[model samples]
Target: MAEKPGLVKTRQERVETRLRQRQVYNERMSKKRRARPRSLNIGDVVLMKNRRPGSKFKTRFESGMWAVTRVKGTLVTVTKGDEVVTRNISCFKRYHGAPADHQESGNNSDHEEGECEFGRVGGTAEHWLASGNLQMGEGLAAQKTTTPGSPVPNQDDVPAEAPAEGSNSEATRRSGLGRYNLRSRLTLPERLRDYVCE
Candidate 1:
């Protein structure tokens, strides 16, 4: 049989196409985890990592519950009863622990003994974060007053949770004091620049 001229080249092209498809699939899988930070208003019930398991990893869950009055970084500062927990994004599963029914028809929403609706806080979280402190003490210790004059917060902007002493100033800097003095002549996209944190 006559040898084909581009058979080898054709096979190489096929492999490259498959590799690109696989990359797209992997990107899509990770995309779901990258949810945009939204307004987690006060009193909004949220779930966090349940680290205080009595036993080993065999019988532990990650569906911690609390109410959000403040949010910073990936942490949503929440208060549950007398205890206030500031959880990193890892320890949080928003919207009532990922609606059980929204998942599958067979899975149960209720928390389990050996596992949980969400997941567990991995060791990497502690490694990545400097302060994972939970304060449920006196009035000043619990409340955050980062905003100037400590004006009473309405619905969207709750009373500033007690940020670390210098943290507030840092937050202010990060909150875009530098960006204000940008080249005023530069034109920024309306939607792109309008991420006013409610």
Candidate 2:
């Protein structure tokens, strides 16, 4: 049987949509490739705009900056406002703004390898570990342990389990590793540190 006119239009629309999306993606990728740096690290703030209606700031810096809180290969984690962004080093740095807490968070060690987007002098995981700040490759929140003002573990390498909802991870104590819902953005470690500040 011959194709129906409705089906033809529908198929055409789908093809058009796919082509448009692919074009946009290609443009973005090429732009990133042209702009990426040799190395990338944590704590760099990207300058990309992600403004919406009724938002506070328009620019990334004014919007609280996109801090390169975590880095692992092409996947670099950055945060600005309520938005947590993860992208490749080149893509992120190309549009990233100035960082927040660049020095304190980025350069935990003096003699180490790799770059830190947050600070000028990049260090290594070992350096950060030596400083007693817990960090992972990516996806780490700015939270600390009992000593206060520490970084949260990025993944299950440390195995931080989130408390079974309803139970207050903070006020209520648990035996094992976990990430308690302490704040809108921060996990239990950051919340614990805030508790100290308070």
Cα lDDT listed for each candidate: 0.50, 0.48
lDDT, candidate 1, 6-103, per-residue tens = 66567779999999999998788768777564656544555565677666754334433455667777667877556777767566655432222222
lDDT of 2 by residue, 1-198 (tens): 887676555777899999999999988998987854446555443544343435554443232335567877677877644567776554543332222223344355753355453334443333333343332212222322212234444556676677676465654434333444244444467546656432
Worst 10 residues of 2 by lDDT: 137-146
Give per-model TM-scores. Answer: 0.27, 0.24
Give the C-alpha lDDT of model 2. 0.48
TM-score of 1: 0.27
Candidate 2, position 61, lDDT:
27
> What's model 2's lDDT at 153?
49
